[model samples]
Target: MTNATQAQLSRTAEFIAGAKATVPLIIGAIPFGIIFGTLAEPSGLSTAGALAMSLFVFAGSSQFIALGLLSAGAALPVIIATTFVVNLRHMLYAANLVPKVRHLPQKWRALMAFGLTDETFAAVSNRYLLQENIQNAHWFYLGSFLAMYGNWVLCTALGVGLGELFPDMTEWGLDFAMSVTFIGMVIPHLKSKPMWGAVIVAGAMAIATVTMPHKLGLIVAAVCGIAVGLSLQLLLKAQAASEAQSR
Candidate 1:
C-alpha cells in the first residue's frame, strides 16, 4: 500500500482504538454521577441546577465539593474561589494535552477544555503520551467525551429520582468512590522516576493541606505534583543528553 493509504488506515485504527478505550471510563463515571446528583439535592441545589452543573462544569469531585461548600453557606466569592482551586488540576490536564491537541483549531481547544474532566483527561493524556502521535486526537477525545457526557446526564437523573427513594448517601459510602477511582487511575501511571516523584509530592502536599477548608488542598496537591513531575522530567532529559555527548 502507498504511504498515504497506510497513514489513513493508521488514523482510522487510532480513532477506533480511542473509542474502545473510553468504555471503561464511561462505566466508572456512572456511579460517580449518580452520587453527585443525589447529594446535590440535600445541598440545596435544585434538580435542574445539579443537572446543569453536570452538563456545564462536568467535574465530579469539584462539583460535589462545591455543592458541599454552598450548603454550608459559604459566601459566593468563597465558593467560586474554592471551586477554582479544586479544579486547578485542569491546568496539569491542559499541559498534558498540549502535544496531542496543539494542532487542532482554537475553537476545538476550547471545547476540549470544557470537556476536560479528570477521567477524560486521564484517558486521553495516557494514550497521547504513550502513542506519541495524536493526529486524530480530536475524534478520539470526542468519542470519550460524548460517552462520559451521556452517562453523566443519565445517571444524574437517576440519582435525583433515587434521592427521593434513598435519603442518606453517607451511609451508602458513595462519596468515597471518587477517591478510590482516582487512586486506581494514578497508580498505574507512576512507573517512571519523574512520575513517581510527582505522585509522592502530590500525596504529601494533599495530606498537609487536608485541614484546609473548602477543598483548597486539592489545588495545592495538583500544582505541586505537576511542578515536580515536569521538573524531574526535564532534569532527567538533560542528564541523558549530557551522557550521550560524553560518549
Candidate 2:
C-alpha cells in the first residue's frame, strides 16, 4: 500500500482503539442517561425534545438542570443562564486541550469540543497527557466521543420508550445510584492538592446553597470552587518562585 493509504488505515485503527477503551466508562453512564431520559418527559419535555437535547446539548448536568428549571416554569433567560453556568467548566477543559489539539482543523476541534465531557476528558487525558509519543490523538478522541454520543442517544431512546410504559420510573430513586457511581469514578482522579481543594470547596458550596431557588446555587458553587482552586494554585506557585529566588 502507498504511504498515504497506510497512514489512513493507521488512523482508523487508532480511532477504533479509543472507542473500545471508552466502553467501560460509557457503560457506567448508561444508567445515568436512561434516568435522564425517563425524567425528561415527566419534566414536561416531549420525547422528541429529550432526544434533541441529548443530540445537541449533550451535557448531563446541564440537561438535568434545564429539565428541572423547565418543569418549575422558569423563565427562558433564567434557564439558559443556569445551564450555561453549569457547563462553564468546559472552558477549562478546552484550555488544557488546546495546545495538544491546536494542529487539527477547525472542524475537528469544533466537533471535539462538543464531545468533551468528563468521561472523554478522563479518557483523553490518559492517552495524551499521561503518555508520551501519541500519533493522531485526535482520532482517538473522535472515537471516544462517538462511542459516548451513540450510547447516550440509544439509551435515551430506550428509556423514553420504557418510560411511556412505566410512568413512575422517575420516582424509583435510580438517580441516587448513578450519583454514587459517578462519585466513585471521579474520586480516583483527585490525585493532587489543587484538585482536592477544588472538590472540597465545590462540595461545601453546593451543600450550603442546596436550598437556593432555580438551582442558581449550583452556578454559585461552581464559580466559588474554581476561584478557590485558582487562587490556591497561584499562591503555591508564588511561594515556589520565591524560594527558588532565595536559593
Candidate 3:
C-alpha cells in the first residue's frame, strides 16, 4: 500500500475515536430534549416552532432560555442577548480547537464552528488537543454532532406530540433536570477553592437577580461567576508570590 493510503486510514481511525467519545454526552441530551418538547406548548411555541428550534439553534441551554423568555413575553432583543450571552462559551471552545483545526480549510472550519456545541466541543476539543495522529478529526466531530442532532430532533418530536398527555411535570420535579444537568457539568470544573467560591457567588447573584426581565438573571450569574473566578485566581497567584518574596 502507498504511504498516502496508510495515512488516510490512520486519520479516519482518529476521527472515529473522537466521535465515539461523545456517546455519554448524547445520552445526557435525551431527557432534556423531551423536556424542551414538553415545555414548548406551555411556552406558546407551536410544535413546528419547537421542532425548528431543535433543528436550527440546537443548543439546549439557549433553547430553554429562549422558551422562558418567550413565555414571559420578552422582546426579541432580550431573547437574542440572553442567547448570545449563554452561548459566549462557544468562543472559548472554538479557541481551544484552533491549534488542532487551524490547518483545515476555512470552509471546513466554518462548518465545524456551526457544529461546535457544548458536548461536541468538550469531547472533540479534549481529544484533538490531547490525542495524536488525528487524521479524521472532522469525522469524529461529525459523528458526535449527528448523534446529538438526531437525539434532539426525535426527542423534541416526542415531547411536542405527547406534551398534552403529561401536564405539569414541574410538580413531578422533572423541571429540575436541566438544573441538575448544568450542576453536573459545572461541578467538574470546581477543582479549587476559588472555583468553589466563584460558583457560590454566582449562584447568589443569579437568585438575587431572578426578578430581572427576560431571564437576565442567568446572564448575571454567568458574569458574576466569571468575575469571581478570575478575581480569586489572580488573588491566589498574588498571595503565592508574596509568600515566596517574604521567605
**By TM-score, is 2 or 3 better?**
2
Per-prediction TM-score: 0.86, 0.83, 0.74
lDDT per residue for candidate 2 within 1-247, as digits (tens), equals: 9999998998998799889878878878887888888888889999999999999989888899899899999998999988887777778778889988888889988999999997888778778887675668888999999998999888888889888888888778777756765676668768877778988998999999999965667767877887888888898899999999999
Worst 10 residues of 3 by lDDT: 169-178
lDDT (Cα, tens digit) per residue for candidate 3, span 108-155 = 888788788877876675567767866567778877777777888998
lDDT of 1 by residue, 1-247 (tens): 9999997777677667666766776666677888887888789999999989888877777787788888999888987788887777788778868867878899988888888877777767767777755677677787667777778888898999988888875468665666766777788787899999999999999999999976778888888988899899999999999999999
lDDT (0 to 1) per candidate: 0.80, 0.85, 0.79
Considering lDDT, which of the candidate structures 1 and 3 is the better prediction for this target?
1
- Please report the TM-score between candidate 1 and the true structure: 0.86
What are the clashing pairs of model 2? none
For model 1, the stretches where C-alpha displacement exceeds 4 angstroms are 1-16, 245-247
| Candidate 1 lDDT trough over 10 residues, lowest sum | 169-178
Ordering by lDDT: 2, 1, 3
Q: After superposition, how far is residue 80 of candidate 2 from its true place, in Å?
A: 2.0
Q: Which of the two, 1 or 2, has more TM-score?
A: 1
Cα lDDT for residue 58, model 1? 79
